[model samples]
Target: MGRTSDAKEKILSAAQSLIELRGYSALGVAEICKAAGVPKGSFYYFFESKEALALAVIDEHWAGQKQDWTGILNSDAQPLDRLRQLFEVTEAGQRAGQQSCGTVSGCLFGNLTLEMSNQTEAIRTRLQEIFDAQVEMVDSVITEALARDEVAVTDTREAARSVVAQLEGQVLFAKLYNNTHRLSPLWANCLALLGARVPQEALAGS
Candidate 1:
């Protein structure tokens, strides 16, 4: 049982890497099996189909992101500091040329929504739920920041949504251009919107 579980995990990991690196539509189950060192028959033992594997990958990705974001938001640091840390984390990943992670992988949910939402109600609903949960997380963080007086904002929910939207836009632009450079202006704009001054050293091109 343990060996079987390990093999299943290996296959899932390989599938995720391929999806992130090459986009979902471009990934093939055979290639994933090869990368995972698993036989084609073994994949069926774990997942019913490639589509099921994709859904599982999406769930795993969301779970990991939720944990990371929750940890950052719940830290003892000031609210603004927490938010800044989140951005810095992403920026560091960008600097490292990590274009394959979920957020910067051009939003798996959004991609699925665009491509398969109309054809598959299950996929569409699942993606919507994921997005809704993300928004709620953002709202929680913003509300906490407001409570702590770490950031001054008139509307926490709106502010949270705005931040999420800006980040999404940055991801889209980064993916479209195949470079993180396009995100700089959006980051600066976000700082301006928040009425906060970005550290000069952290400014793009600085």
Candidate 2:
């Protein structure tokens, strides 16, 4: 039982790394198994297909990300400040990934959305749900900021979607350019999208 479970985890870890470096379409089950140090049969035992494995990887990645986002977005800090921290955390995370891997890995969900969303209905639907959840989280933070008059946005939900889109787009740029610095504009851009009432310079010092 222990070894069986360990094999499954090894496969997931290996698949995520390979997918980040290359992508889903370029990989094969045998190659994934080889990287995982597991037998090809073990891949079948755990996941019925490569797509199934991909979904598992997406779920696992999002589970960790959701926790990090909840910590920052749901923090006791001022609402807009929480949003700023979220951007800061994103930049830091991308920088860390570049240092570790010599390139930006970008957001997994975003990457898969571009690479696989149209290729499979199951993958498309799952990606949509994940992104929708992200928008909802951002919407909650924006709504709080709206209540405090920290931002001038009348449509918090739409503003939140734009903010999330901006973040994802910046991350895509970071990955495409293989430079983490490309993510530096996220906070400023997010504030602009929200019609933040605070001066950008003042917010920076706060």
In candidate 2, what are the lDDT values of residues 1-206, reduced to their tens digit? 34999999999999999999999999999999999898898899999999999999999999999999999999999988898899899999989888988999999899999999999999999999998998999999999988888888889889989999989988999988998888777787888788898676744223
lDDT of 2 at 180: 81
lDDT of 1 by residue, 1-206 (tens): 34898989999889877876776677788899999998888899989988899889889988987788889878888666677777766656665645345344565566666667787666778888887887787677777766765456788777777887777778778777667666656545555545444465554444
Error of 2 at 135 (Å): 0.5
Q: In model 2, which runs have C-alpha deviations exceeding 4 angstroms?
A: 200-206
Instruction: Let me know the TM-score candidate 2 reaches against the reference structure.
Output: 0.95
Kindly report the root-mean-square deviation of model 1 from the true structure over all alpha carbons: 4.0
Error of 2 at 68 (Å): 0.5
The 10-residue segment of model 1 with minimum total lDDT is 95-104
